[model samples]
Target: MPRGRPAGVPPIGSYTAVGDSFTEGVGDPGPGGWIGWADRLAALLADRHAEHAPPGSFRYANLAVRGRLLDRIVAEQVPRAVELAPELVTFCAGGNDILRPSGDPDLLAERFEQAVAALRAVVPTVMVCTGFDTRGVPVLGLLRGKIATYNAHIRAVADRYDCPVLDLWSLRAMRDRRAWSEDRLHLSTEGHVRVALRAAQVLGLTPPADPDQPWPPQARPLRSQVRRDNIHWAREHLVPWIGRRLRGESSGDDVLPKRPELVPLELPGAVEA
Candidate 1:
């Protein structure tokens, strides 16, 4: 554990990730159904802490569900995480809320701060995340203002609790079209890798590679192709998302956490950034 941690807080080794689709590995598929940045970051943390702990002792859990509301995360996931009391907790919420038509950043910030304060009380480290810079995303780009407002509050909450911020908004690599999946919502495989690399850096661990590595040069798609792709995207992804919202349904309606417990984590080519 680093020096000056609250006296009773546990040492750093175990980690728990909390949030929605982003942390749940929506866009990045792997050995399992999805392997998001949290899993990748866990592999890096395990490798770095290996010498200091027994084999298989570095544990990790991800309590994120897709399309979850920030209040639900606080009401359900937060308490469970507190019970587990892992040395490190990455509290990422509010993105789903920011997307709602009636989302209020200031109100969400109050709730977010409460969760962070509670987690910080028992966990040696509590990391927070900001929403992505949605300027280049399709429909989401229109709500960039809402996301930005939420991001600002997130930074303030992290600062108040002395927690580190995974400033996704500042990651310039995300602006590229290649960073997202066909839905133009969740990240693509490359996007998850970039996020993981950035997260490792945020945790003060040496990243295996650069988060902002340049993509190979390629010709832009034809204007006609862009129009077809947009139409296809609306039918396949966007329309369904809107329907779900209208019906008050979610992609993760009853989905369980990918990794519900802080057990030993298996390291494989699963997280080669």
Candidate 2:
């Protein structure tokens, strides 16, 4: 069999990711680019390839767009992923959709199921992720219930399809303020790394490192500092997000997928600018 053969292929080779900003690595900006969880996952998978598969056989593509709704993800990215027909596919959607003022959880769940079913029919190893616990996010704490509801639906869907689920809601480590960006909407670089490690474990990769390590203690901001920081965050992130919503625009409006096609995997250090 070929090293990257589909049916009996190892998890390390040929992966495709589809969904929204959460998968796109929004807040975790890097010198190379935005090194989101998906990118980190790719790197981890590539690292493991040396054990079971050819070193250069691992490949990955991320078709996630920031601020995308569930329907748009299915309509646009899923078909492309299907065409690519990777050995593993990871999907995280509905987070952006559920954040809308008129968000409908039940309707979104129905759509989510449809997408999962579609992917499961073709892909051998499909993975779905749950939304994070939002109780720690300032101004977004009230949405925890909503996120929990969506996560429950995601679990049910994953069960029906026999797909591995990266239950982000269950990870207490992610609740730390340090795991998030100032926007409090996306993960920090450490957060993305942790998530990728967890995803690798879920895929039976058993990464060399662990994702559950405790974060170092952070200094509690002063009351005055908290207020000042909140003001700055609102001015920088929240205001622009609200403005985009009002204008019916998205951060990904003119942007293309960071990695559109699957190519031989290259670690950050291995590839030069």
Best prediction by TM-score: 1
Q: What local distance difference test score does each model get?
A: 0.86, 0.82
**Residue-by-residue lDDT tens digits, candidate 2, 51-71:** 787678888899998888888
lDDT of 1 by residue, 1-273 (tens): 211334443335899999999999899988768998888888888887776778788999999999989999998888889988997888889888888878899999999999998888888788898889888677898889988988888888877888878889989899889999989889998999999888878777768798988888999999999999999999999899999999999999879998888888885776767
* lDDT at residue 232 of model 1 (Cα atoms): 98
Q: Clashing residue pairs, candidate 2?
A: none
Error of 2 at 39 (Å): 1.0
lDDT of 1 at 12: 59
Best by lDDT: 1
